[model samples]
Target: MNNIKKSQLFWASCLALLVTSLSFGIRAGILGKLGTDFQLTATELGTITATAFWGFPLAVVIGGFIVDAIGMKRLLVMAFIFHLLGIVLTIFAQGYWTLFISTLLIGIANGTVEAACNPLVATIYPDNKTTKLNHFHLWFPGGIFLGTLIVILFNSIGLSWQIQVAIMIVPTLVYGYLFSKLDFPVTERVASGVSTATMYKSVTSPLFIFMFICMFGTAITELFTGQWIDVLLKNVTDNAILILTLTTGVMVIGRGLAEPIVHRFSPQGVLLISAILAALGLYLLSTLTGNAIYFAAFIFGLGVCYFWPTMLGFVAENIPKSGALGLNLMGGAGMFAVSVYTIFMGGFYDRLILKKLPAGANEADYLSAAPGTEMANLLNEAKNAAGPEVLQATLVIPIILVVAFTGLVIYMKNKKKEALTH
Candidate 1:
């Protein structure tokens, strides 16, 4: 790559990562306000949040063909358009349905970027796939950090979230222009005379199936938290952005150091640790009265910092010849994992009602509390009408799921090792 084109690709990747993270963070910061502005029922709001993942699966599946048929540069430019348009549409949304539609589109834009740029990065850094992939992924949290700053600043300035969301357009335009000037990689399969149909079947292998489940947990850790933190933390503190900031800050730092950690501990070990921290983080964040929430957020952020991007890297490292199709196949499966987690969590959320009324509180009081309100508030005054120990039991499900997932990842690595030795 020429120096200027290299720079273009560099900025393009950074800005793409930025836009992807901002998509969720902006939603997190504005969700409360959007709920009030649009008179959304909890059900309606859940749909809007869930919409972000709806297109991810399709984007990944279609991206394989798109990247090969066109080119990475062109596809990335298209992704930018989707993101920019999604943000633009979001700013003008006047009702719950409108917001849901807009978020669905943003999900597609973000998913296409995953399809295009993941392979782009690996092709650009073939000799250092894991290291460069980590570097590329650092931008996801870095963008969240940037978006959070805007949320706090503009929110203080009384910029309605509509206006705040509109600000992201500048970076979108910048990235689009930069990507337009670059030359993206050609398909390795095409270069070697391998056909596209052969590439698609490679994603159906047993190894890919195991990795797909692992990616699903990765989505729960990243999206379930990124999109819902403000709602989740509302139970603990009024300052939701502070918690989001802390989480993203930890994520960026963790991913920044991921290159070395993967070298030392291996990705599977890191993933194992990530799972434990994620579970603890959810447990702490769920309980409002304790100081453990902060520590939990920190630990959870550290664990997930590299989980999403690294998994994409794992597929590439393990299946180097799979090319853009492999990357997209892995990316699509990862997003599908996220969509499933979101849908599953949506089902489980109603199960979290406060059931064991603390002391004097009535069920009505718990029902009327704010979005993240804790059950402890009932305190002898409220009657808990809901299931007893709601989160107490449901959260264990995620922990179990994540732990077993880590083992599957290890199994993949071990199998690869055995194949190599044989």
Candidate 2:
């Protein structure tokens, strides 16, 4: 432990995570522009977006299995190479296939960062897993806030989306340099002398399997809505990007103050409450209009702020024997679910708009219609009508979460009682 530089290593991990999140924030901000420029349908755009989600799980799950053997430094090196390649490819992207490949590269880089960092943080701060993990993860929202603000700033000045993406390279290079020079400690599983077989066995436990399933709902509720916010809320809000910015800003603050909150409610209690607030927030977003939507964004941000980190922290603290595999598996599952749902939601949104069009109107009728023509007007109206309905349709996820988290809370309580009795 004395050979390792803890503060320097931790901050470097934060910076690496910042780069990963910047990719998410920037890609989300540019989604509409890509669609318009490439003449893509909502479903096609969704497929491109889903590539990142799916690619993420692939890297994280694979990286999880080999991280202990290959070491954190090697994994981060892979992230650095992929980040550069992905950014350059995206800048030169011509159409659907190019965008899909580039976003997948970036997603792989993003997942690799998490695969290394989550276990790294857990290893260094064994005394305060949940609170410290929350602090470490604040950067996810913090970086998103910065990314959205960059988009707003660049767009306001008539800058190209390509330029917005290029800004990520600076941070990528910085984190790459930092990790290159630093010495890394062993993973928590190795440090604690837990056997590989024991770690494998632990992940198959009932509680772990339960949480793995629950992660799908939690992630889709947060990431799916966030990534699609611009399109989903464009008709409902004046500046849909601002809604994303505001929510991420609120999340940064909430995660920063997580220690006391976790102390008061415990992780299970917080998850239950977060599920309730998230459901209410989404419902409000579906029904609210104008300035009132900001309030809903705030609530939504608060609800999801602690979800990702807290979930990881719970597994690390309770199932220590499961090690890096458990942590990465949970994250990988969440991302995989989001990938599948992204396409579903996009198709669903497209279908809703199609259903709302007049009987004789086909998609071509709207796309080929000249601006200011009656067909164009009808298409606009249909989009406006379908947007809120799309949000309403997503409410089922968080609503189900409310029930699921309640059960988790009760289950944890019983487990605690049984432990005490023994």
Best TM-score goes to which candidate?
A: 2
**Clash total of candidate 1:** 12
Candidate 1 ranges beyond 4 A from true positions: 2-4, 192-194, 288-291, 350-394, 405-422
TM-score of 2: 0.97
lDDT of each: 0.71, 0.90
- Candidate 1 on 1-422: residue-level lDDT in tens? 66566556766888887888887777878876786666554346667887788776688679877787888777787788788788988989979777988898898998888788887777767667776788888888887877888888998888889887887888888888878767776755666576767676767777766766667667666676677666545655666667778888898887777778888866666667777777776676666444666786786688677777777777777766577877777677666765666655544543343234444544444544665556435522221222113334435645875667667667867887999999
Q: How many backbone collisions does model 2 have?
A: 0
lDDT score for candidate 1 against the true structure: 0.71
Candidate 2: regions farther than 4 A off: 2-4, 368-370
Query: How displaced is residue 295 in candidate 2, in Å?
Result: 0.5
lDDT of 2 by residue, 278-324 (tens): 99988988888989999999999998888999999889988989999
325 Cα displacement, candidate 1 (Å): 2.5
